[model samples]
Target: MERTLSSDLAFENNSAAQASMPLRALSTLMLWQRRLSSRRQLARLDSRLLADAGISESQRYEELGKPFWR
Candidate 1:
């Protein structure tokens, strides 16, 4: 009976962990999507707009190609 109880507890913990994994994955995906969108939007801007942002045209191109620093 004690072994069964422990097994049930373990199962519950595992289930909760599994449920959280997908939420974490979804959040990560959303973050990446936002970053990519921002990068694309920045890339679409003309040189004048980039200059206004104080970002060099060449730098913008580099940043747009690789948005994530980490």
Candidate 2:
């Protein structure tokens, strides 16, 4: 009986973890998309806008060069 209960608990935990994987992947994808979009917009900003945002060209370049995952 104990063994059966343990197996059932393990199964439930595994199922819950599996269900969460898709949510995690979706969140990661959305995060990457937002990062990429913002980087593109930043790249398009003029010097005045960048200065207003307190970001230098070199800083912008560094941020723009980073992969979305970073």
Candidate 3:
């Protein structure tokens, strides 16, 4: 009975993890997508807007050069 209970607990833990894995992956993907979109927008900003945002040309270039994961 004790062994059965232990196995049941383990199964529940594994099931929960499995269910959450895809959700976590989707969340990560969405986060990267947003980052990429924002970076692209940043790269397209005019000098005036960039200045307004306090971002220098070098800083914009540096940010644009980074991967979304970074």
Candidate 4:
């Protein structure tokens, strides 16, 4: 004879939310790198391309002026 248990189902662990600090820091660093790369690309966009993306020159300037950490 065998018996089934339901108590274990109530103890699910949230592993993702408990990620290690190094992993978290790596993800944050990647985000900053992406921001820097994107800003560089935005800085190189021509006036026509900027207008097509619905971004004005002043708006591009503001975004490009921001620090990568931001």
* Top candidate (lDDT): 2
Worst 10 residues of 3 by lDDT: 1-10
List residue ranges in candidate 1 displaced over 4 A.
1-8, 67-70
Q: Give the TM-score of candidate 1.
A: 0.68
Better of 3 and 4 by TM-score: 3
Model 4: CA > 4 A from native: 1-19
* Clash number by candidate, in order: 0, 0, 0, 0
Model 4: per-residue Cα lDDT over 1-70, one tens digit each? 8977656544433344455667889999999999999999999999999999999999999999899999
Q: Report the C-alpha displacement of residue 62, candidate 4, in angstroms.
A: 0.3
Instruction: After the best TM-score superposition of candidate 1, give how far the Cα of residue 32 lies from its true spot, in angstroms.
Output: 1.9
TM-score of each: 0.68, 0.91, 0.88, 0.72
lDDT of 1 at 25: 90
**Which regions of candidate 3 are displaced past 4 Å?**
1-5
What lDDT does each candidate get?
0.83, 0.95, 0.94, 0.87
Q: What is every candidate's alpha-carbon RMSD to the true fold?
A: 3.8, 2.1, 2.4, 5.4
lDDT of 2 by residue, 1-70 (tens): 3534578898999999999999999999999999999999999999999999999999999999999999
Model 2, 23: alpha-carbon shift in Å? 0.3
- Superposed Cα deviation of residue 40, candidate 1 (Å): 1.4
